[model samples]
Target chain A: MVRKRQILVIGNNTNGCTPKHEKIAYDIGSEIAKSDSVLISGGLGGVMEASSHGAHDANGFTVGIIPQDDASFANEFCDVVIPTGMGLTRDYLNALSADGVIIVGGGSGTLSEACASYMHKKPMVAIKNLGSSVDPYIDGYIDHRKNIKIIGVDTAQEAVKKILELITA
Target chain B: MVRKRQILVIGNNTNGCTPKHEKIAYDIGSEIAKSDSVLISGGLGGVMEASSHGAHDANGFTVGIIPQDDASFANEFCDVVIPTGMGLTRDYLNALSADGVIIVGGGSGTLSEACASYMHKKPMVAIKNLGSSVDPYIDGYIDHRKNIKIIGVDTAQEAVKKILELITA
Candidate 1:
């Protein structure tokens, strides 16, 4: 049996994200779902919510690595809520769990996730013009010596395509 | 009855930290223990290991928020190991569980913890010259308008003292 790909989506919680970011995240979610891949996120508001919403609309499975121990904090679109009382540190789990990561607009939290993804050596694709805190480091891998690279793309469709190619390659 | 103060120590895991960082972390741990406060860390290696060792020597309670689900991942100095199974996302719990935070030399993981502490409104103190990734944001709090501040000090003793004052105030 072929293993279903798990694509982790990292983004702003809500207050920091713009409507354009939300649309991109939603599209990314939909694309991942259409490809028969599972969508995973931090399971809160903003980008997480938007992406999960898109995936759910497409009848795709969505998992949320919630910081709280209870599933109550999970967004409405999350189908599988893994309540990890670990809090923001859960970004490591979010990154490690993914076959690939899709980054949207975010602040410090999103930046943390991006760093975690790089550290874990996961393939990452950042949607361009998100103005995320991870932007500063996106141009290069974690360091000159590391093989990990974060590909940049303009649209969600391109991000999905690139991520699929990366993971499959 | 007074609750025992919990001090969160943020630093790099073994692979990313230096001997100087380990020494400073050890001193901070010792100071925290002598002050009758519990030491908290991510519980992997490097600064976390050194600090936990110092706290153990001083007969202080040590808590490690382990990223893995198994307790075996926790360092020897950790008196209590909370197997978060949440990976790096556990940084949020490590920050929120503390009454205050002490930053030693750190990398991406430490940066995440510092950001989490700021977002949670926890008092923080960075040991100067530790070369932590949080240096960029240490001067100002997470928000310019917020009253929260991360005090910087030259010595471990001064850091402990300042943190106590901030928490007490």
Candidate 2:
């Protein structure tokens, strides 16, 4: 059986994010589904829920790695929820399990997962100039190692396409 | 039933560490086991293996969360092995699951886990003057957030005792 590619999307939670982030994440999630890849996220409210909602609506597989131990805490959109009971550390797992990552708009938590992706040599891309916390790291490396550049784009379609290309390349 | 305390040890792998680090980690592991707490680690090599070996020799429970998907990749010292198949991202899980953390000699991977622990508000302590990558954050906040401080200790016994106290307090 051919393994379906797994794509992870990281971003800000409800309070720290704007509505635009939600729309972008939703589109990215949908595009990932349309591209025949599984969608995964932190499984919480905000960008995570929005993306998962999009994927679930598009009839795509969705997985959520929640910080809480109770799977019920995951957004309703998650088809397969794994309650890690480990809190934010679970965020790193989302990055680790994915073939590539998309950063819509995020703060420290998303940056932490991004660091994990960089350390693991995973492909990643971000939506440009949304004034997101991840802006500094966009179009550049996360640190001095210069492991991989986080490609930047204008739309969710480009975001998903870029990640897939980077991964396949 | 009272839950047994879970302690996490993060540090350099075999290649980046010195023999002294191994000895220090082993002692820390033994001390934790003697304190009747479970020992947990990355389950790969160097500090992780030594700590698990110490705990196992002391007939204590040891859990190894391996970065690879193969359970066999874990050190034989591990009583329970979980292969995350998520690469370095699995390192964050070690901090999330533990009530407290101990830092020996470590690299960027360890620092990454340290960031997770801080975000989750997990208490941490490190060996002083070990020249590990985590030194900067020792006794200080990992970031401007300053959620928690990584205290400094001189010995394994002090490390174990301090963590138990911090958790109970």
Report lDDT (CA) for all predictions: 0.84, 0.84
In order, the candidates keep a fraction of the true contacts of: 0.27, 0.22
- Supply DockQ values for each candidate: 0.28, 0.17
- At residue B47, candidate 2 shows an lDDT of 90
* lDDT of each residue in A59-155, candidate 2, tens digit only: 8889999989999999999999999987776776787788999998776577678778888889999999876545666887655456788899999
What are the clashing pairs of model 1? A88-B89, A89-B88, A89-B89, A89-B90, A89-B91, A89-B92, A90-B89, A90-B90, A91-B89
Give the per-residue lDDT digits (tens) of candidate 1, residues A1-169.
7879999999888787788988999999999999999999999999999999999998899999988999999999999999988667677788888999999977777777777777678899898776676675675664433557788899999999999999999
| Off by more than 4 A, model 2 | A1-6, A18-39, A50-93, A105-112, A115-120, A126-161, B1-4, B30-38, B52-93, B105-120, B127-147, B152-158
Least accurate 10 contiguous residues by lDDT in model 2 chain A: A129-138
Q: List candidate 1 stretches off by more than 4 Å.
A: A56-61, A64-93, A141-147, B56-61, B65-90, B141-149
lDDT of 1 by residue, B13-116 (tens): 88767888888889889999999999998888999999999899988989999889999999999999999886666777788898999988677777777767
Query: How large is the interface RMSD of candidate 2?
Result: 4.2
For residues B144-164, what per-residue lDDT tens digits would candidate 2 score against the true structure? 456888999999889998999
